[model samples]
Target: MGTTGVRTDRLGLLLAQFDQARETAQVRLTGLSDAEYLWEPVDGCWSIRPREEAVTPRAYGPGAWVIDKGAPEIPASEYAEVARQAAGGMSVAKIAEDWSVSVERVEEVLAHTGEPEPDVVPVTTIAWRLGHLHSGFAGQWEWSFGERRREPRLMVDFAPSADLALERFWAELDRWRESLGAVTEEQLDTVGFSQYPYGSDPDDPFISVLFGANLELIHHMAEIAVLRDLWRARFQLPAH
Candidate 1:
């Protein structure tokens, strides 16, 4: 195949992962409210507050917003931990399909997946991981694709509340998806993002942006899954 064919193949995989992750996270959010959404593991952990003043972005270098009122520096690497490690596998399109099951087969969600559980140590709620991913992903994307991201470093607010944050973040993501669907190869070739500090462009490629979104979605979705299991253990809510 030609270069355009190769790029199109990759973009198709990325968008699928993006949408799949979005659906999984939304499933986690069902029936939850604002007050229930904000609950975290401890006092110092991060959260998206209804008011802007509640959580500062963090002060470090130019364009670096304060995270907490006077919180300490948080490295981009710190986010990678909360962000889901790869679930292990190539992008789905690359995987062999079962003709019998069909492409539409979906898994029913459960409180636990039998993966080893996180230790009982404390930090923040499941939603905080999503917020951290939003900031890190946006900052990295801006630096690479859009412009030179000023430092100490920076983060973006996906939402004021956990209930809304994922939904709001999805809106931005939907635009990106539209860009992928609508932009001609000529446009994408000329219009590129900075994505600096992360990797070299053209060489590094825009697929990384989609990959970041995929990673963020899976991580938070898993965190919510664990939380659901915990909630079940505590309250014994019926599987509905």
Candidate 2:
């Protein structure tokens, strides 16, 4: 086949894969309720909360977003270990004073001290996942292809509700698709065509960047799907 024909075929194949991933992501996000979108089945589950209520443990860490609440003085993960060390000897007042939480909450924590620590991968709300995808596409497009301007975006800018989030997500996908379609054979084959500074793109070919973006979208979409399933089944699990 001719060079033009090969380029067309390659781009076509990539586009098809991208569209399939996009459709799967859309399907995963369909019909989510607000509560479900923000569900936190376990403490420290990263979900969209009001600025005042944002409780993700990493929020307080260095490089956390300005809007994200700082981590509690005593992280939720450490609570179990701390309680175990106390071994039913630590008073609620002492625990609360040390952790900087309400005494009532401390008592509750003490009661559940014997339970295993939550093994979560920093659960994020559906809204957060959707917003993250949208921003990721937008940022990569802007940094790698469009104008090369590093404009920062916040998750809240995507959408406040599931319906709006889906709408915005598809719109960003469409923009990404357009950018993908515009890549010529020369651009794709050229090393360092994508200069996305935050990633390895500066040292990679445009095609590699495209493939990486697909993997990211697909993996994150699957993660969101799993989170939704867990959210739906949150009430069905028997207490340990």
**Among all candidates shown, the one with the greatest TM-score:** 2
What's the TM-score of each model vs. the native?
0.53, 0.65
Worst 10 residues of 1 by lDDT: 102-111
Off by over 4 Å in 2: 1-8, 52-121, 154-158, 237-240
**What lDDT score goes with residue 179 in model 2?**
80
lDDT per residue as tens, model 2, 1-240 = 456664347777888898888887777677888777766666665544454454544332112332233345445576665575357465567566556668877666666635555644555666666656666787777876678766534323633466766776688789889888888989888877876554446656788889988998998889888888887777796879
Q: Model 1 segments beyond 4 Å from truth?
A: 1-8, 42-44, 49-122, 140-160, 182-192, 196-203, 236-240
For 1-240, candidate 1 gives per-residue lDDT tens digits of 356664345556666677777777666668765555566645665554444345544422222222332333222333232122113332222111311122222111111244433343335555555555555555554554454655314445434355566675666555555656654444334424434453223233455555655776687668877866665466565698
| lDDT of the candidates, in the order given | 0.49, 0.67
Clashes of each: 19, 2
Cα deviation in Å at residue 235, candidate 1?
3.7
Q: What C-alpha lDDT, on a 0 to 100 scale, does residue 166 get in candidate 2?
A: 72
Q: Which ten residues in a row have the lowest lDDT in candidate 2?
A: 60-69
